[model samples]
Target: MTSSVPVLMYHYISRWKNPIAVSPELFEEHCAAMARNGWRGIGLDDAENFFIQGKPLPDKSILITFDDGFLDNYVYAYPILEKYGHKGTIFAVTGKIEPAAAPRNTLKQVWNNECSADALPRVDQPYVKHELGFDERQDPFLNWEEARLMEKSGVMRVSCHSAWHKSVFISPEYDGFYQPEKRTRTFDRIDSDIIWGLPRFKALPRLANRAFIPSQRLLAAIRELVPQETDAAYAFFAEEANLERLKTLVQGFSKDELGSYEDSMSLQGALRQELSQAKTTIEEELGRPERSLCWPWGAFSPDALSIGKDLGFRCFFTTEMGPNPAGCASRIHRFKAKDKPASWMMMRLQIYSRPWLAKLYSSIRL
Candidate 1:
């Protein structure tokens, strides 16, 4: 039987030596190391062929997948991959792809800034621009041209990660969970879409499948909460407290603003629409159809998995750390990059490559 390959996951490729991001210099070093070591990068199709046909993969075969499609991928990683002539798969959040630049440090903005843990102004407020390294107004993500160029190079592949990068299908049951840091901003935008925007959007009237929802209803619910009404402030605070209590239902999960059931379900629908368009456009541009996709944030419900299946995707990848197990429903495993490449990956890969090690790790982890 053909063994599964190590699917290396990466996020930002920049000069910054941060925890989640690796400097461009280091990224070059890592890729060079792989190439020098005789590892060959494989595209999704190649990997699937190895699984389906039991065909032998090249020595050191690896799949390079980048999550959240950072601008740096275009700015930095692209040149390096081109240098090595290796292909990569970029799973991008379609909705978060701004026309120009958006604020970076998104994880920081949402987790630390919004929580008031950091001195920085909350991302939601129209506070005058604070300095981040990149251009403020420009979308912090890659533009259409960059993505197109990468696709044209034949060394990079792009896949859907949902328009909004929110979870779906598994949401109704787990209400009040994860949310974006500029969550208020997103909620406002969605409100605009439902309220003033949808009525004017031609498709809203035509899509018989879309369930009509007024922005005002959501607006009203938010207002009924404590901050909006001071007279009922005491009662409202209690209600808010109750909402917080409901978060624990999703076992082993801490609720983020995006984790809210309403947000999940609504964003899922919004994402599906965006994904449909993206898939069509991408296929047209690439001159071929893609049968594989990666989950946005690696969060999906059984229903979401089923949706992808219905959409005709042959396989889906997940960020869940480890190697892809044979006969494991095609929910392949992936690993993320740290500021430095650690022994963690080497050890895990060894374990995954060997069935005995995998059994040991699974027993310990699961």
Candidate 2:
């Protein structure tokens, strides 16, 4: 039996000049390194058994995972994995897939809102930019054909990552009921973090502006509702009771920004249905149900987790980085690789192999 192995998670593997993008050349080199080292790339099930059943994988086994179904994984990572006869798992964001080639603007324009410097409290901008976005329909983020082709290749295994990558807090008004402070603070924290955390903070005024500008209409609604309460206390109470139903929503989004509480829940339900349909399709192709899943952006809450579990998935992946010791949960830890060309992976792999360093990193980060 082989010992536990490192499960590597990736998002985009491309030749972009952005620091976040892992160049094709470097990606190939990393795979080549793994091959030379006699690493046997395994699937999620292999790790599950090793950790849960006390089964050992062949020595040098590694599990490779790609998150969000980026097109770069297909355009860039797929050929390399095939070249090395390596196997990997792709956590598909099912909502991103389209029947035909989607317009380039849809991909890029959706994620394009540069976050505000003083980030506002609203749903994290649901957009992706094309020069900045990976075309899910056209390129690497696999369309139906590419996904089926990859699944048939024997080296690639596909799984789910929710329909829209909705965060754990995505549903209406749930956060205020449980984590109001954390939820409220997200508006400011996201603003400051994105601006200050990035290399060029000053150039990102759009991020601040994008967030702080509240819709003028919601303010008016709030004002009108408050005044009429005294004049028609009974009628106001009736309306206020209905409005209270939107407290969580109002905390998250203005009534004008979002039509009503029911609308929000409807969108969330639609997303869950999309995920269920994608999982069913992927399973049909595999001739077996996909019992595992990965959260998009590693964003999930009890509601999201329940949805995944109810959908019949056995395990889900996360971004908590480190070696998952035997007996560790399947909702495992994975680190982000920023510094690389192999040095970054190698260092972290070494750290994960060392209990002390793993403990140190967790403690410091926590």
Candidate 3:
């Protein structure tokens, strides 16, 4: 009889400001633990046989997947897996994979014939926040050279994440979100954008000038509501109670001025484009078909699933914290393998290995 095994999901492999990030040390420990134990890594073919053809898996089978295609995946995660004799699948953001970037650090210094797994983290740069003044719409990702090495070695399977992870994070209506110069986001630069935004809006390019900066009155309201330091203003914005208020304030702008920034963010078209590009590019680059897809932020609608099926992606992985139900592997769920220690993950694997326990927990949670 077939049993449901755990599929682990991961994001950035770094020590950064992100809550989703997992440190390299901790990650290595987790992989080592899996290797020390009897856990075996499975490929897309193994998964397809079990899920699509209803074939049972080998003993103690597990699936490791990484999202976003961060360069750190190669720097940190890949070598560890290779050393431990484990395997993984990196669902890469295709469009972000190729940029003429040097190694971030000096370990081995090889993007050419000298390419070894020793010195990487290529491109000496910090993990710049995308929302900041940096044009990080497609950076901090693996170059084709690194990707090809990983894929050819059979240690990691390079699959598809999507074309651009941007449309998923940035609000479609917030034109100012993209324009770092317009960002008075820092505490020291608390100068209200409302004073100069309107004139600048008229002067800038149509697509470039899309953010709806706060009006003078709205700025005053935010100030009055928080009335202290910049931190208080930020706290107010951070609070859930301020969402409706923020919406009301944002609506004060003229529709013509705000443009589609105020429009309901429908990413169906964007998702289609991304999925198509990711599949095509990954296949072209890696010489393998992309059969699985992990959604950005684990947010996907029914329409997205439908579109994915049409695009030939059979497996859809989500952020939902639970085990994949037996015979229902088309839409699988995974828990974040970051933040927690290896021991915690060990316990999670234990629970998942026993279907009855997982079923009981799910039933209670549901």
- Best-performing candidate as measured by lDDT: 3
Tell me the spans in candidate 1 whose CA falls farther than 4 Å from its real position: 97-139, 167-218, 221-275, 325-329, 342-349, 362-366
- Ranked by TM-score, top first: 3, 1, 2
Q: Give one digit per residue, the lDDT tens place, for model 1 in 1-366.
A: 336577788877765444557776677777776676566667767776665455666656778888776676766677677787678888776655545333233223334345332442222222234242222232256656667667877777777665555321222132232221122122123222221111111111111122233234433444433243323433433465544543332232332322323344764665456557656655654567767767755756565566666666666778776556444446777766666653444454456655466556756775
* Candidate 2 residue lDDT tens string, 216-290: 454454444433332243233345464464353355554346322224465457445755876886676456778
Every model's Cα RMSD, please?
Answer: 11.2, 13.5, 9.4
lDDT of 3 by residue, 1-366 (tens): 338778888876776545667877788789878877878767766766676656888767888888877787887777777777878888776776876345353222332436564455543234344443333332367778778787788887878766665322122144321112322211112112432122223222111122233345544654454424433444454566664555565567664434323232434555566578888888887787778887766666676677789999887776676666555556677767866788888877777666687777656766
Local error of candidate 3 at residue 302 (angstroms): 1.7
- In candidate 1, clashing pairs total 22
Task: Give Cα-based local distance difference scores for all models.
Answer: 0.54, 0.55, 0.62
Q: lDDT (0-100) at residue 79 of candidate 2?
A: 66
Candidate 1: residue 50 Cα off by (Å): 2.7
Per-model TM-score on C-alpha atoms: 0.62, 0.61, 0.68
> Largest TM-score belongs to which candidate?
3
